[model samples]
Target: MLVSRCKFTGISAPFSVGAFVKHLAVPLSTRLHCALVNAEGGPQSRAVHCPKFQALKSHQKEQLHLYVDALLEWNQRMNLTAVREVGEVMERHVEDSLSIVPPIRDSYLSRCGASCGKISVVDVGSGAGLPGLVLAIAEPDWQVTLVESMRKRCVFLEHAVNLAGVSNVEVVNGRVEDIGNDSCFREHFDVAVARAVAEMRVLAEYCLPLVRVGGLFVAAKGHNPEDEVKNAETAIRSMGASLLQVCPVESHGPYGQRTAIICLKGHPTPRKYPRSPGTPAKEPL
Candidate 1:
């Protein structure tokens, strides 16, 4: 009875994305294969029954295998993620991030009567490049800009992007608030994504300003999103946006329950949005 529930919304279907993994010996090029071999008791393994891994094409599974190896290797030296187990990485890190893709494609690509075009996407607070780098790998035509305030994480992201051979991604080392206001990036994206970034109300302030009018902001959230969504109503409205849908994702394994809180940028966000550096978090909306 694994169910992706969109409570308080009139939806019966589970949230899913376009068909988009594998286990292997320590992958090449990182020079730490041996270390990963012994660390965490062994290489992170995958379950064939996992929904996300099964949907991936064989080639994609291979690429994910390599990416996981790199993540495990780098995580030992620097703090990347709290989920250190191989199986956990497969579910929580890889699959949890991939869940946002379905809504992204459905909302952004098909926004104009079924016509598709190159899309500019910004991944706010892209620590360790979870869904951002993942999205870049999954969608070649979509240009992805990963924004992170910490230099160390950005360094890791650069390395991962290069090793993954994804040419469409750029790692921008800066705060989202600053980047959101910059003329070069502000209101220029077709879509924006944030995961575990901040509370819903504060998150709206951080991400909505980056999307162009008629664009989307997809927030990868956890199980209890109703209250957050209720609280963020004012911020969403004031920021010239509206809730498109709350898509509950079926994370059948260790990934647990997830939600994609989709917001439509109906009009331009007020120029003063996103407030100062830490204002949104300290005092929401």
Candidate 2:
């Protein structure tokens, strides 16, 4: 039987008056800042203001700052993301990543055992570790594995892992298709998550195989996704997965909408899944 052993701590933080005035380029509000800070570490973790970041736990907010800074720096050399300013990182990158918590928690609980101990999760095609590293940093218990096909991105992922001082995370340099078939990877994880990687059908092929029976495959999508869900039904079923639910996610204050498609693995994935790296992308289902 599937169960939920995962614990999600939502970080919440608010900006002070001085912080608001400094980032005049973006209309920063104390309430929104507070919501995001809280969302990052949750209400109980810690809270921080500029110059001095105080919280129940020291270093989470600072760690968040460092990760954002690294992404911004690397973005200059490679086009990782368009969010240029620091404020944008808090809104677009940080909050956007954290918004998946509800769906992730709900899906896991409905399926496998509670999210405790070394609950495994693999992020397929984790370009710069969007939800993977972000989730790892927030919830320390998850044994997070980030799989990346590109060499440069893998290097950046390693740097991010070390910078974050996260011991529970690992970076695997390979295509999702190749990694999924490895005996060690097939049916190995409690959850498999992908964000902005591809359409649902294509992603199911790349992700579902890595999830054990009764585990979940969560696909993070932007905006309305009714049609994509419909198109992926056949592929999802073929991969021994069934769509369990679709959860809508939004930032606490004036944030955009995000969708997470939760599919539960009903049986062991076919051994031939995750064909060639480009095959799924080239021809979904």
- Per-model TM-score versus the true fold: 0.80, 0.76
Q: Give lDDT tens digits, candidate 1, residues 231-261.
A: 9899899889999989887776564788899
Q: Return the top candidate by TM-score.
A: 1
Q: In angstroms, how far off is 158's CA in candidate 2?
A: 0.7
The residue ranges of model 1 lying beyond 4 angstroms of the native Cα positions read 1-43, 47-49, 109-117, 276-285
Error of 2 at 116 (Å): 4.1
Poorest lDDT segment (10 consecutive residues) of candidate 1: 15-24
lDDT of 2 by residue, 116-191 (tens): 4458988887887787988887777888988876656665676667776877788776666666767767898989
